[model samples]
Target: MTTEMGNPRSRDIVLIILSNSIQRLTFLPVYHHATVVVMCCLWLQTKQSLFPIALVTNASVHVIMYGYYLLCVMGLLPKWKRLVTDCQIVQFVISFVVSVLMLYYNFTGFGCSGILGRCFNAVFNASLLTLFVNFHSEDYAKKKQG
Candidate 1:
């Protein structure tokens, strides 16, 4: 899934732009805007080393999710829509693990940066995870029953 973009920074920038643009165009929920703002704040802080993990994971998920949308747009609806939701859930779980590790390191070690941002991120991630899980259950449960 690698692109010809030789520079990682360029790829990150493009992904961020595309993600934000898509979010705006789709008029995503308020929580999505909050997540974007929190991420921007985390990125602006120079000391937040863990921000890249969140960025890369989220960007990767967006790539997959949007790719699915593209397929659907071309009248090629894939049967693996559930996989996108699964990937999103996995992304949040990974974020939770990374956030916990960040907290542990902040307390036990020299201290990590963006501790406050991490707290906000944890709350947002939890809420998003709950929403995604509910969507998965309701969507697929009805599919199964009907």
Candidate 2:
């Protein structure tokens, strides 16, 4: 349902905000972080110390990503909202590429369990990126038109 101004309703806005926050704090991070830990475990089991270092670095990327997403949701820097919205495209690209790469590595180098973790990461990233793109287009794209 549309507001009188043809914008979304307050309820919709609140729901969107809550949904975004929930995805950031829970769904996205859980899979990404879990994959990192699982990969670290796999690396340890295989006596591959260098792999865990890469896994930690990969985790740091998600840290920056979710941290910024939370900042946007919190409106801690309202001035940056437009910037964040625009940057969402770039963020999605980065996340998608990373997930795909990790998935490829896990599939090639490890067994069933490692591949499963990477698959979770891939699915999470896909969902998160889809949300970002749809939100950006619905929110910002229409603003530009009118």
Candidate 3:
């Protein structure tokens, strides 16, 4: 009887770990965008202005990507996963676009430079937190198995 219970408990642990992994991967895109936004904000602090063209491009891409994530969380966007879906792909796209746009905006000096510490961040935190939390615990397992 003890052996039977032990195996079952181990199975539960494995399922929980797998679920958490899925949760982390699913949110990778948002996390990547957030980190980039944080980096951009840090860069802007010393510059005090986002007028340079390169700055404009990078800032714009980040804003767009952030917007995508924000909308997705609010169910404004489609569920991220599809037949070919992987959240990391979205993240990679955001990173690449941000880099390319950074250079472009830097050249043109046209961009929305400040989106951090504003509605985006607050909504980002709230939505992502809630999104992941819902994927956790007994509720998630039930959903997963069903």
Clashes of each: 0, 0, 13
Per-residue lDDT of candidate 1, residues 62-118 (tens digit) = 789788978987999899899988998999888888777777888898677778787
lDDT of 1 at 41: 60
Any idea what lDDT model 1 has?
Answer: 0.71
Q: What TM-score, to 2 decimals, does candidate 3 have? A: 0.24
**Residue 114 alpha-carbon offset, candidate 3, angstroms:** 24
Q: Is candidate 1 or candidate 3 better by TM-score?
A: 1
- In candidate 1, the residue pairs with backbone N, CA or C atoms under 3 Å apart (3 or more residues apart, or in different chains) clash, namely none
Model with the higher lDDT, candidate 2 or 3: 2
User: Each model's TM-score?
Assistant: 0.74, 0.43, 0.24
For all candidates in order, the CA lDDT equals 0.71, 0.53, 0.44
1-146: candidate 3 lDDT, tens digit per residue: 13422332234334446657545433434453444455445545644233254345444545554556568658796443231122323443443455445446645876444433222333443454444444443444675699
Clashing pairs in 2: none
- How far out, in Å, is residue 70 in model 1? 0.9
lDDT of 2 at 127: 72
